[model samples]
Structures are given as structure tokens and as C-alpha cells.
Target: MMREILINLPIESHEVPNLRELVGWDGRHSDYPTLFERCNFWAGLRVEKNNELIAFGYVAGMGLQHGYMEDIIVHPQYQKKGIGQSLVKKLLQESERVGLEIVTLTYDSKHASFYNESGFKPCSGGLWRKKD
Candidate 1:
């Protein structure tokens, strides 16, 4: 079943550290609060039974022509259960609902097939890159 999703909410006490530990990053990332506050769109997937945040992702942009997906994190315990794909699909939908002309993301190629199934293509298809 699909879990509950919380949208556009402020980061909580546990979230950034949760993500940091999941990905093995060290140090307190002081910049994340400001960054999370500035996201054009973001969401957290909550476990239905207990409302625990198990996954999250965000898109940052100027809210005009494009959005860039970043910081997609799924707790290690929840990996491979389709949670990551679901969060990403939600971000994609938000970008579209806001009338973005395009959306882009970079991911480890180990997960290339997942992104392909989620409606992304290679940058060579001429849809993404930094402006000249």
C-alpha cells in the first residue's frame, strides 16, 4: 500500500540526521535548514501505521521553467520496497502542477532503470543542463 505523504512542511528534528546517517555523511549540515525552507517543492513519506518518516525528496528551482530534483533519501530499512520511486513520482507531479517546462535529476547509474521507468531520459535527449 502507498504510505501517507506530507508536503511542503518544515524539516523536523530527526529528518536531516536521519538522511545523513542513511547515506553515511558526517557532520551537522547547518545549511540544510535554509535549503529545506527554500525548496520549490518537497515531501516526506510517512509509515501509515505510526506516521514515521521513512523517505523524502525535494526539488529546488526558480519556479518558472524548470526544477532540479535533489537529496532523495530512503531509509536503509525501507530500500527496495518501491518507496523511493513513489517519492520521486510525487516530486515530478508537483513540478508539473507548478507548470514547470522541464524537470531534471541526477542519480547513481545503479538506479538508472528506476528513473527510466519514472519518466526520465538521458540528458542527451535535449531536456536538461545548466544554462549557458
Candidate 2:
């Protein structure tokens, strides 16, 4: 079965946990809707056969000139198939379409090659440590 990519669609509230599980990230943040709904963009990868969400990623930056991409992950079974790259490209495309000047994301050093291949360059700058 082929896979399809759906961009900028409102994510149903029920699927938040599954989306979080894709990367095995922090699960303690129980208030997912508050955060997810506030995002400017969301990209979901789904199976064409059943419309099941297999991967997800999003951006947060006031939907303005700057965007910080986060939570980019693909299902374990779906990794190495370029799905993540596709999501990243779609996110970049949509953000640029809105006239965003720059897009940035943080990733593990081990994934440097992926970000580099995706047209991202490292820039030294201030770190986020406190809330505004």
C-alpha cells in the first residue's frame, strides 16, 4: 500500500499519544492539546490503505518569519524510507510559502547528516533556557 502525506490539517485530539510514541519522547506533558493546537503547522504521514497516522512533525514560531521545527519522527517500521525527509521538505515548503525568512530545528548530533542533507546549517546562537 502506498503512503500519503497530509499537511496543515488539524490533528484529532485522540491520536496525540500515538503521535508522541513515534519518537518515544517526553510523555509527561499531559496537556498535549494546549501545545499541539497552538502550532502553526502540522504534517502527518498516513497509510493510504487505512488513513492511519504513521508519522508526525510540526513547527512553532507564531507562524511568522521564524519557525522552530520539533517532534519530527517516523514509525520504527517506517524509518529509512525517506518519510521523515518528505515531511521536513513539506514543512519547509509550506513555511516558505507563508514568507517565512528562516526555519530551524534541533536534532541529535547523530542526525547531523540528515539535517545537512535537508539544507540546514549549524549556527551558534543563544540557547532557550527560560520562559519569556
Candidate 3:
């Protein structure tokens, strides 16, 4: 039997390590803290079994019209279990709740099918990275 998954917001800072592990990110990095500080809305999903954090995602809004989904990840063990879809759906709902007219997320081409199934469509965009 599969364990129930619970999704909630206002996640505690102590859970960052688990999230880093889930996404293979460096726990020592301050990116997670910055995300919590900067994101307009965020959510995390936990497995009820051991109360382990198995998924996380966040959204940031530019005014009330555009929302960007960021840092979506699910533990490899939890992939293909609908956890990712649930996370995306939760972010979309939050975006709608805030009156966002457009929602966007960036993902690798290999993951296009997943986002496409979740109602995302192909669109052209550009990115510019500032040099350190």
C-alpha cells in the first residue's frame, strides 16, 4: 500500500536538508532560504509514513498578472507516483488564488512531457544570466 501524502505551506526551515536531499542540492547553500524569503507562495509535500519530505515547489509573482513556478522537485523514489503533478497543481491553484493571468515554469526538454501533461504549452522565451 502507498502512504498518504500531505501538502502544506509555511514549511519550517529545518526541513531544508530533506528538500536538498530530495533534489540532490547542496544543503550548505542558502538558496532555499532565499526562496522562502522571496517567493510569494510555496508548498511542500510530505509522506505520512515517516513524515519525510518527498516533494517541494514554489511560485513567485510579478505583480498580479504573472506567476512563475520554480524549484519543483520530487524524490527519485517518489517519482511516477503523481506527487509532481500534485505539486504543480497546488502551485497553479495558488497562482489563480492571487489573480495571476499567466503561469510559467522552466524545465529541461527531457521533462517536457510531464509539464505538457499538466497543461503547460510550448512557448518561446529568453533568459539572461548576469555574470558574477
Candidate 4:
């Protein structure tokens, strides 16, 4: 049987704990509060059976005309299942609706293929970093 995977966006703080379990990101438990407060942007998650979070992603920055995709995650069991692509397409569409000029992200080389397949290209001249 094919399992259902749904992308639910902008989940509330209370939902973070479950996502933590799904993704096993211990840092998220400690850092998400401050991160969320600073970002003040909508986040997204993929839910299966309308209950469990199978994947998650978020956007940051107020310059809606040129935003960035901050995070995208799919549960280990759910990778290579097309869930990530659906999530990305939705993100791009939402960004475009607000007149976004570009949606950018820096992927680890190992994961570059996934993003490239989703229509993302390398920036020949650009810099990105995580602020502590």
C-alpha cells in the first residue's frame, strides 16, 4: 500500500517536539525558540496520516521580493519519495505570489543533486553562512 505524505506548513511551537523525534535534531529543541523568534517567518512540515510529521522546511527574511529557503528535511524513511520536490514547488509558488525575485539556498555537495533536480542552480558568485 502506498502511504500518504502531506506537507503541512507553518506548524506551531507545540508541534516542534514531534518534529524533533522525526528528524532527531537535538539542537532544534534548544535553538528553535530563539531561531523562530528572530526569523518570524512561516515554517512548513509534511504530515502522514494527517498526524505524524514526515518532513519539514522553512523560509526566512523579510525581503519577500528576494527570500531564502532556510531549512528542508525529510525523515530518513521518506527520502527519495517525491515528498521533498512537492514541498519545494509549493515554497517557490508561495514566494512567487508575493513577487519574490529569487529563492536561494546553499546545499551540501552531497545533497546538491536533489536541489538541482528541483530546478536550482549553483550561484557562480555568492556567499552564504549561518550566523551564530
Candidate 5:
């Protein structure tokens, strides 16, 4: 059986540290100010039976031509059990509601197959640069 994940409203700053720690990949740990500036984004959180956050996904740029999905992470302990899929599905539905023409995301090659299964197409066009 699949465990239910709940997305509670009014997410707080206290959750940021835990979100940072739960991520398994290397990412810039966003502070409260950064998170606040991006609060227009939405996050879906998976809670354990005892209400601990076990997984999450961040979605931004609603109603735009290019909406972005970022920080979709499942705590290692709860991975490979459809939590990620459920979260993505919810985000996609939300995007469709907001008139987004396309939803895009960037992920590691190792997870390419997973995203493919979730209906994300692999594209070969883009210029990316990181600032130091």
C-alpha cells in the first residue's frame, strides 16, 4: 500500500532547514529570505504517519509560457515508492490549471528514465551558465 502525502497550507520558515537536509543531491541551500522571495512558488510535501516531512517538490512560474519545476526530492528512505510521481502529477495538474504552455525541469542523467516515464521529453536546446 502507498502512504498518503499531505500538502499543508501556510508552509513556514522552520521547514527550510529540513528541506535542505533531506535533499540527497548537491544544491544551494536556500535561506529564509530567498524562500520568501520565491513564495509565489508552490511546494508539495510528503508527510509521514507522524507528520514528518519526507519528500517535497517546488513549482514556479505559473501561467507563464515556461513554467519550471525544481527541487523535486524524496527522502532516501521513502524513494522508489511513487511519492515523487504523485508529486509531479499534482504539479502538472496545477500547471495546466494556470494556463502554462509548457512545464520544464532539469535533472541528472541517472534520473532521465524516471522523468521520461513521467511524460517529460528530452530536449537538446538550451544555454546554461552558473554564476560564481
Candidate 6:
């Protein structure tokens, strides 16, 4: 049977828990509501098999000139199925449509080839996290 994969669907605040769980991120679900509300641009994909959310991802950013892609994840069982690539491409398209000059994302070194294949080049930058 063919599954249904919806791209760039409207994201509801209730979906945040599933997204965080899929990516194995530890954070308060409450934090996502406000964060998503403030995003300049965002896109989400939902891969549904019999109405279940099997795979998902999204990119959120703050500025018109530079957009950051985030939480691009395909469920462990669904990796290597091109879902991540499609999700990223969808967000990039949206970013460009909104006049964004650059779309940026950070990923682990192990995933470099995937992003490279998706047309991302190695670039230098720095990151600093605030102490909590």
C-alpha cells in the first residue's frame, strides 16, 4: 500500500510533542508554542500510514535574509527514505519564495554527505549556548 506524505502543512501547536520525541530532544513542550509562533517562516511534513504520523520535520528561522533549518528528522524506521531531503527542499523553497537570501542549518559531521547531496556546502560559523 502507498502511504500519504503531506508537505508544508499547517502545523498546530499540539504537534510539538511528537516532533520533539521524533528528534529525541529534551525540552519543555510549552517552549515550542511560543517559538513556533514567532518564526518568520516554517514548513512541516507529515508522513502518514493509516493516519499515523510516522515521519515529520520542519525548519524555522528569524530573519528575511537568513533562515535556519531545524528539527529535520525522519523516524528511525523511516530514515533513508528521502523524507528528510524532501522536507529540507520544501523549506528551502518556501524560504526563497519569501525572499530569503540564505537558508542555513547545522547538522552533525556524520550527516555531512546528506546535506551536501541536498546542495548544502561546508561553511564556517560559530555557536554559543547560554548557560541555564
Strongest candidate by lDDT:
2
Q: Rank the candidates by TM-score, best first.
A: 2, 3, 1, 6, 5, 4
Model 4 stretches with alpha carbons more than 4 Å out: 1-10, 17-26, 33-50, 125-132
How many steric clashes between backbone atoms does each model show? 0, 0, 0, 1, 0, 0
Error of 2 at 1 (Å): 2.1
Candidate 1, clashing residue pairs? none
What digit string (tens of lDDT, one per residue) describes model 4 on residues 28-86?
56655565666525435545455556666656678557778866777677778787887
Q: Arrange candidates, best lDDT first.
A: 2, 1, 3, 6, 5, 4
TM-score of each: 0.81, 0.86, 0.83, 0.72, 0.78, 0.80
Candidate 5 per-residue lDDT over residues 1-132, each given as its tens digit:
334544433456656556657664544555554754663355556464656666666666634676888777777777888888888887777677668778888888999988998889999867679998
Candidate 3 structure quality by residue, lDDT tens digits, 1-132? 334333345566767656676577766455656667777877777676677667778788664798888778788887898888988888887778779889888989999999999999999999889999
Model with the higher TM-score, candidate 3 or 5? 3
What overall lDDT, based on C-alpha atoms, would model 1 receive against the true structure? 0.77
lDDT digits (tens) for residues 51-94 of candidate 6: 44545555566665887777676666667878778767777777
Deviation of model 5 at 47, angstroms: 2.7
Model 5 root mean square deviation, Cα atoms: 2.8
Q: Give model 4's TM-score versus the native structure.
A: 0.72
Looking at model 1, report the run of 10 residues with the lowest lDDT sum: 23-32
Which 10 residues in a row give candidate 3 its minimum summed lDDT?
1-10
- Off-target runs (Cα >4 Å) in candidate 3 are 1-8, 26-28
Q: Give Cα-based local distance difference scores for all models.
A: 0.77, 0.79, 0.76, 0.66, 0.68, 0.68
Q: Which stretches of candidate 5 lie over 4 Å from their true place?
A: 1-8, 26-30, 36-40
User: How does candidate 5 fare on TM-score?
Assistant: 0.78
Residue range 85-124, candidate 1, lDDT tens digits = 8888888888888899888888778979989988899775
**Model 6 bad stretches (over 4 Å):** 1-8
